[model samples]
Target: MDVRTAQKLVMENKHAKGFNVTDVPLEVCLLQGEIAEFFTAWRTSEGDAAEELADVALYVLGLAGILNIDLAEQMEQKISKNAARVYERGANGVMYKTTPEQTSAEH
Candidate 1:
């Protein structure tokens, strides 16, 4: 039900099939940084934004290839994690809050 349980299940399932590319957060964050850098360059335009974006996108794609993760799926997960609060139950949902790391682990 929780993130820890979900991660445990993933690890358990992976035990039987011979898992690969275990760096989930690292790979995801690396791509995210690249994405940020790309947008930053695009905004500044003091450098080659197009080339920077292309290279970062390609590296991100390569990382995705190694991890066998779909960018769309990952993006959806990221959005979902960021879009709503899991702790909200009553009418006072706005009171609930979490950190960036906690949000990241949920995905």
Candidate 2:
């Protein structure tokens, strides 16, 4: 019931009232905090971990909506780009840049 209400709110607020790149960094930081809390709960077997994770996912979805990003489509684009790269798969079945330091050097 709570989840359904959240989903309803998400759908209702699908469109953004305005554009703002400044909000992205703040939202990302909050997302990181949510992730940490979620993992902490999960590792300790605190039953609310799943709900925390769901809340974070919903927040990210809202961020994507505000950016007009279409999260699902953008994720597909990411997959396509990743598949074209030559990196080996990690335990998460996704590959990351070889080295964070060297990768940042290139950028």
lDDT of each: 0.62, 0.68
Runs of candidate 2 exceeding 4 Å displacement: 1-26, 88-107
Please give, for residues 1-107, the per-residue lDDT of candidate 2 as tens digits. Answer: 44345544564554344423347787688779888989989999976998989968877776665566667766786787666566668999997666333255674
- Cα lDDT tens digits, model 1, 5-105, are 44444445455666444676776776688778778888987677888787675555545555656665777778987776455445864655543346456
The lDDT leader among the candidates is: 2
Would you list the clashing residue pairs of candidate 1? none
Query: Each prediction's TM-score against the native?
Result: 0.39, 0.55
